[model samples]
Target: MHDVVIVGAGPAGLTAAMYCARGGKKTLVLGNTYSSQQSMGGLYENYPGFPDGIQGIELSERMLAQAQKFGAENQTEQVEKIVPLSNFFRLKTENWQYEARTVILAMGAGHRPLGVPGEKELTARGVSYCVHCDGALFRNKAVVVAGYGNGAARAVLYLANIAGKVHLLCTREKLVAESVYLERIKNLSNYTATFGAEITEIQGDDFVTAVGYKVGNTPRTVKADGVFVEMGMKPNADLAIALGLEMTPGGYVKVNRLNQETSMPGVYAAGDLTGGRLQVATAVGSGASAGISALQYLG
Candidate 1:
């Protein structure tokens, strides 16, 4: 049995493992950290101490290395289920099962895809889910923001500041976002919004060159250097759900703001699973909190 078992290897999970292992707790971190959105983000400019910025994958690798240096064991297997026992918890992965006195759920969320033609083929070529991650790459180039909601609006706004032109397409009758964002979008000359639109395909050969959509019966195409899909995210909280943990209305695991402790004792959640900002920096902070809390629980 291990002292602590973290269910993710992303920024939050790695940070938690680092702290737990350094504290002399036998910690094991499961899951592929590179598959996380943070790693797919490409580059990060907001993470502290890196004035020149750093690649997301590199950052995740560094965190993992630090955790391992501190004696945190790791596995790349995906956890299928988590079972709560009388005292400890049992985690079942594809090939093995682990028992731990304490558990930390750091499984991050996955981005919702457009599922349109050519989108999958040109993912890194020109289509991206994160504006902050790939926006800089398309500086002064035209781009299309697919979907509607606060996330879509944020993508439009962020892209507008970088791209030469920003097109916001939505299937709804109206765009849904905060009043502040809506007001800001109106003042941007390079930003355009079209509601009641359905994306049919993403066109490109080597890189994204255009997006095809239909507004009512009228089919239209817009030239774009990049396509940013902001359809929201699906949090990997199935294990948390099976454990009967309290979650927010948005389906994120609910945790104590002060300590990242979940509704259940000795069970903590951090990073995207706990929701909020959903940034690498925030994930690290939350992971640190969860680690310290788990240590205290053990003591």
Candidate 2:
């Protein structure tokens, strides 16, 4: 039996692993292979302590390496279910099962698809969810954004730096997000805001060619290299839910603020799965909290 079993490999899980391992707990981190932060191309500039910025995958590697150095074990597996033990927890995967005295849930956010036609098949070909990773590839090209939230606004601002022309398509009546981000997007010459718009379909023969949307009473087409779907994201907390943990109305795991403890004893949660502000730095802080709580519980 392990002392702690963390169910993700994102910033939070890795940070937790580092702490638990250093505290002399046997730590095991199990997570999905591709959906984690590393698949988003690893470039993070906003995280603290690193003024120069770093790649997303590199950052994940660094975290994993640190945890390894402290004697944490890593595994790639899809967690099927988590069952409570008399004094511990049992984690079940497709191929294996393990026991742990404490658990940390940090599955992070899952990609929220546009749900429009041709979105799935044409995902990597032209449709993307991450602007920071794919924006540069469309440099000097035209692109369309499909949301009006802060995530969409940030994507537009980021894509504006590379794309020649960016069309902001908002599902809502008007642009309503952070005033600072709204102001920045509004000031950009290459950025064009289209409120009350919705993407109907992504048109492409093999790759993305253009995007068709309805603006008020009219239908319009925007030529584009890609469509950056910044329409928010959903937290991947099904495992936590399946295990019967208390969750917020929006499906985020509910935890005690200072200790990151869940309603269930010996169970803790952190990161975007716990759903506060889904930022890298905040996730790290939450991970530390969960790690310490797990250590305390195990002791």
Candidate 3:
């Protein structure tokens, strides 16, 4: 049995592993970078310590390498279920099972995909979910934003300055957003918005070349270099829910802010799963606290 088992491999989970392993605990991290929200991103200028900025994948690699250097074992497996027992927790995967004295939940949120043809195949090629991470790639080029609401409006405004032209496609008759966002979108010079615009397909061989959509029963296509799906994020909370843990009103795992402890005795949560400012820096901080708390609990 391991002393601590972290159920993620993102920045938060990797940081926790570093702490727990360095504290002389037998640590095992169960997750990988495949579904990481931050990986596959371009440049992150906001994270500190790297004034010149860093690639998301590189940053994740560095975090994982550091944790492994401290004797943390990483197994890339999908955890099927987590069972809390008398004094330990059992983690079941498709091929293996492990028990741990303490657990840290850091399963982060995921981007909502457009669910259209070529959407999945063209990810990182020309289709992206985060404008901030991939907008610079489309500089001076044309792109389409397939979404509505405040997130989509803000994306239109942000892309207006980067891309040569930005088009907003909404499936409704009118854009649904707060007045402030609507006002901001109206001021963009190189932006066009069409309501009742439904994206039928995202087409490209290697990179996105155009967007297929329909507006008011009229089929149309727009030549573009990138497609940004501004749909909101969905938190990975299935395990938390199944474990009967207390959750916040937003459906995120509730945790003690000071120690990152969950409602259960030896269970803790951190990162986007706890739902605060979902950023790498904040996640690292939360992970540090959770690791320390877990170590103290084992003492």
Candidate 4:
């Protein structure tokens, strides 16, 4: 049995592992290869100390290396279930099982995709969920931003600066966003936004060439190089739910704001799984807290 087991390889899990290992606790981090949502991002400008900005995948790798340097073992096996014992916890993954004195569930959320034909086949080949991440790829190219939520509106504005022409396929009759989003699109010269867009299919051979959408029953197709579907997020809380941990009404793992402790003793949760600001910085901060708390628990 190890001292601590962190069930993610994202920013939060890596930070927690680094702290726990450095504090003399044997720590193991179990996760998939592309575990962090940040890995799906591109040039992250908001993260501090990197004025030039850094790629999300690179940052995740750096965090992982740092955690390993501090003696945190990294495993790519995804956890399938967890069994809480009297004194420790047993984690079962695809290939192995581990027992740890303390457990930290850092499994972050995943992006909700737009269910449309060719979307699954065209992802990364011109179809993207994050405009902030993949927007740079469509620089100076015509692209379509779909949806009417705050995320979609923000994408329309952000891509207007990057893409040559941004056509918005608003899925609702009216934009369900703050006034700022609605007002900003009106000033864009290279942008056209319309409401009640029904995306029929994403047409492409090898790469995305156009988007098929409709304004009510009238069908239309817009030639574009990329499509950015800006829907909201869905938390990865299956393990938390199965563990019987207390959760927020929104289905996120509930944790103490002060120390990141969950409803159960010796168990902690951090990052998007706990449902906060959902920024990389906040995840790191909460992860540090979870690590320190795990150390304190062992004492």
Candidate 5:
């Protein structure tokens, strides 16, 4: 049995593996190609210490190399289920089963689709979810913030300070997020709020030039450099639920704050699956905590 098995290859999982290996534990990281960090395009500027910033793929590669240098093994496989045994946890992959003394879940969150025509085709060209990662691309330009939750409100507040104008759109009649966030966003003069609207189409050839939405009986369109979809994300918590770990009402795994310890004694969680601001830096930090906790559990 391995000392630890990390269930992702994102920043969080890689950081956990590095810490575990450095702590003298044998570590195995299992992940599928589809879940790799390369899918997130553009340069990450807020990752600290990078003045000019680094590409997401480059940052991920650096982390992966660092983990490998510490002797952590990686496997490209989708874990099917996890079964806890007498003395170890059994990780059942699609092709086989392996055992480990401890496990860390850092699979992160899944993006929500806008479900509008031309959205998939114009993803990088004009659609994005991360404001810190892509907000600079639209500096002094008009952008659309779609949603009314905390993420949407936060994005609108941030964009209002940078972008020339911000259009905050929501399908719901009233904001469903925290009252404080709504109050902050409403005070911005550059931000305009639209309610009970649903985007019908994202139009542009090879890029997004404008967005079409309907409010009540009227259709409206806005010219924008890009559209930020702040509709929130779905956490990858199936394995945690399968292993009988407790989850919050939002479907994220419940964990102790500092150590990132889950309900299960030998299992832990970090990153977006545990819920918070979904940032790479926070992911790595939480992963470090989970790794240290797992090491202590093993000891």
Candidate 6:
């Protein structure tokens, strides 16, 4: 039996593995780190210690290497279920089952898709969910931000600096971003916001060339090189739910902010799974907290 078994291999899981292994615990990390949403991000300028910024995939690799160097074992397997036993937890995967004294759930959130035609076909080509990842690729080209709320407004602001022009199509009556973001968006000369607009389709041959939408009863098409869908994200909490862990109304695992401990004993959750700002820095911090708490629990 291992001392700690962390499900998920994103930044939070990797960081927890590094700490747990360094603390002399037998740590095992399940799932592929490269498959995380963090890895989908192209370049990260917000993460600290990287003056020149780092690619999301490169950062994930470094985290995995660091954890492995500290004696944490890793397996790329999808966990089917998690069973809480008398004093330990049993994690069942397709190939194997693991018993651990402590468990950390770091399964990240999945992006809510636009569900528009051509979006799937032109994903990497020009359609992206993360503006920070693909906005730079559309430099000097017009792009469309589809959705409302703070995420959509922030995406528009971020893309406005990189893309030649930014068009925001909001299904809501008005943009629902923070006042600061809304104010900044208004100052951008190349940014245009269309309220009460619904995206009908994403059109492109090999890449996204235009976005089809409707404003009220009028249909419209905007020329663009890229489309950013920022509707939001949904936490991946199937295992947590199955294990009977307490969760927020938004479907994220509920954990103590101090120690990242879940409602169930010996179970913890961190990162996007615990809700809050879904950023690499926050994930790393929370993972560290969970690792330390698990180590303390083992003692």
lDDT of 6 at 223: 94
Candidate 4 lDDT, 1-299, residue by residue in tens: 99999999888999999999999999999996364787866557679999988988899989998998989999999999999999999999888999999999999988778888999999999999877668889889999988777677778878888889998888888889878668887889998877788889999989999998888689999998999887667789999999999999988999998999999999999998999888899999999999999999999
TM-score of each model, in listed order: 0.75, 0.86, 0.74, 0.79, 0.71, 0.79
| Candidate 5 C-alpha lDDT tens digits along 1-299 | 89999998888898999999989899999984235533363456568989987877788878888888999988988888999888789999889888999999988887677889978889989898777678888889999998868667767877788899898888689778777777787689888878998889888998889999999779999888899997778888889898899999999999998899999889999888899987789988999999899899999
Q: What is the lDDT of candidate 6?
A: 0.91
lDDT of 5 at 174: 78
lDDT of residue 4 for candidate 3: 98
Error of 6 at 245 (Å): 1.0
Q: CA shift at 73, candidate 3, in angstroms?
A: 1.0
Which candidate gets the maximum lDDT versus the true structure? 6
Worst 10 residues of 4 by lDDT: 33-42
Please list the residue runs of candidate 4 whose C-alpha ends up more than 4 Å from where it truly belongs after superposition.
Answer: 115-142, 148-165, 171-191, 195-226
Error of 3 at 185 (Å): 12
- Most TM-score-accurate candidate: 2
Better of 3 and 6 by TM-score: 6
The alpha-carbon deviation from the true structure for residue 243 of candidate 3, after best TM-score superposition, in angstroms, is: 0.6
TM-score of 2: 0.86
Backbone clash count for every predicted candidate, in the order shown: 0, 4, 0, 0, 0, 0
Model 6: colliding residue pairs:
none
lDDT tens per residue, model 3, 1-299: 99999999888898999999999999999998645766755457679999998988899999999999999999999788999999999999999999999999999887778898999999999998888778989999999998877667767877898999998888678888778778878788899877888889999999999999988688999999999997766679999999999999988999999999999999999899999988899999999999999999999
In model 1, the runs with Cα more than 4 Å from the true position are 114-219, 222-228
Clashing pairs in 4: none
Least accurate 10 contiguous residues by lDDT in model 1? 37-46
Clashing pairs in 3: none
Each candidate's lDDT (Cα)?
Answer: 0.91, 0.86, 0.89, 0.89, 0.85, 0.91
Candidate 4 CA-lDDT value: 0.89
